[model samples]
Target chain A: MEQFDNVSVSKRANVYFDGLCVSYTVTLADGTRKTVGVIQPSKLVFNTGAPEVMELVEGECRVVLPGESEAKTFKGGESFSIPGNSSFNIEVVSALHYVCHYG
Target chain B: MEQFDNVSVSKRANVYFDGLCVSYTVTLADGTRKTVGVIQPSKLVFNTGAPEVMELVEGECRVVLPGESEAKTFKGGESFSIPGNSSFNIEVVSALHYVCHYG
Candidate 1:
């Protein structure tokens, strides 16, 4: 896989995790728009009502939703989700880098 | 409103719309991971079978989904949506800046 380095995400409240596995920002929404680092990989659980927004920044990953046997693959420029408290699994296949905002 | 400049979004496949009203990237996902800039804002219509992923970078905006009377306000670090095929309105209140990858 190719690698890109020394990139900076400009903007007052930009939350990007491409270079580092963490996002950075400061705003009123999402609690000051702070950097939310990756905690751990999770399994996609359907009907859990937990919605999440995943921003694919770099590398590849898989998103598993309900009734979905095969995990949906996504690269660094796409995004999928388990909406509004819907449970799901996010597996970082390669070096995953992306920003995310969850309620 | 405050401004942030000279920020680069690192990563070979990254889509960030800040500094300019355009986002840039290159990858396999979402059609060669191209830069998808903001064209225009539409009304947020809920239950329209359209889902969207919004990456808020800088500035402020509003997203109005159907069944909801008032438009939901989002700042420089938050996002909302009108599902797949769902029509919606995104008003760029104060120099909006963000990234979006849609299908």
Candidate 2:
């Protein structure tokens, strides 16, 4: 979808790595928590407390999942899953627009 | 308010000034448009296509509105208005979080 309808969104953004990554919290009508965000072209490591499925809306990146030696490339319309309590390395090849669905 | 409820938010963001400023478009139920954004510490100039009310949620900045010789300092819980078709110069002393109401 191009947009999330009838949701609650935080006005304040979550800025990471000195603003290389910026995201807003979004709550669906059913109370599902998600984050719509953009990651500027940069390499970053992210640790997850909850299992996450990152749905890319636009742009490109290569992600190395937990225990994985090979990096998987993903782009707009693709997605990748990360296990809970795991850390992943991501190198954004282009500005990445994504919606993170959390467990 | 900390958030906007019952709104439609675009999945993609509006990235400006090479990612110095990032904002997401939000559409209220009644069709009013707004943007929740963050501006990293920097000096930047912005031109407006419509009248805008910039409501700061956090951080600080000095803004020189159109036709104003002096820059006015504004911080969290403060706001400034900019006329349509005008431009403003803002020097961000700290990262700024804001909600922009536009017409």
Candidate 3:
């Protein structure tokens, strides 16, 4: 996505696997926070407290959230959404590049 | 910068400060490596073994590399280049968003 005005990238952070999965927060002037990250080849599960929109910006991955019977593959320019308080599993076939907007 | 066609965001890595400044490498099909990161407010020095072009994708920072008399402030949409084997100091006034291409 083109850079948005008033969005400031904040201190770096991480999740799940330490250096294998990394990301940074993009905080807007209005206090809205979005995160951008890249996940290396691996399989992992995540539990989230808020709704999230994940946009694939570079590589690709397959994800199967709770209640889903099959994982779906997402490539660059594709996106997926997850409800709040849900969990999901991901299998990284290639390096996965994504920007996640949470609400 | 728009995501390139062949660039793959790889496993996470870091330098200098922990958690405060974070980035991930983008490896290309040709084996070239680039890094994208966001820096929180702080002052830090970095040493590089290869030439680098730092592109500011969001926010701003002031940088004073070796052989430079005064630090230069760079805002979003701007970029600066550094020679190999050099060291540079950065004073982050705001969260700085950048992607570095090295050769």
Candidates, DockQ: 0.11, 0.95, 0.08
| Better structure of 2 and 3 per lDDT | 2
* Ten contiguous residues with the weakest lDDT in model 3 chain B: B3-12
lDDT of 3 by residue, B9-28 (tens): 43234533644566866555
The residue-level lDDT of candidate 1 at B22 comes to: 28
- Return whichever of 1 and 3 wins on DockQ: 1
Interface Cα RMSD of candidate 3: 10.2
Q: Residue B30's C-alpha lDDT in candidate 1?
A: 23
* Candidate 1's DockQ: 0.11
Q: What proportion of the real contacts between chains A and B does each prediction keep?
A: 0.27, 0.93, 0.05
Pairs with steric clashes in candidate 3? none
A14-85: candidate 2 lDDT, tens digit per residue: 999999999999999999999999999999999999999999999999999999999999999999999999
Error of 3 at A76 (Å): 1.0
Instruction: Report model 3's TM-score to 2 decimal places.
Output: 0.54
lDDT of each: 0.45, 0.97, 0.72
The sequence of per-residue lDDT tens digits that candidate 1 reaches over residues A1-103 is 2322222333333322222222333232223232222212333222433455666666676777665877788887786765674566666666555555455
What candidate 1 gets wrong by more than 4 Å, as runs, is: A1-103, B1-50
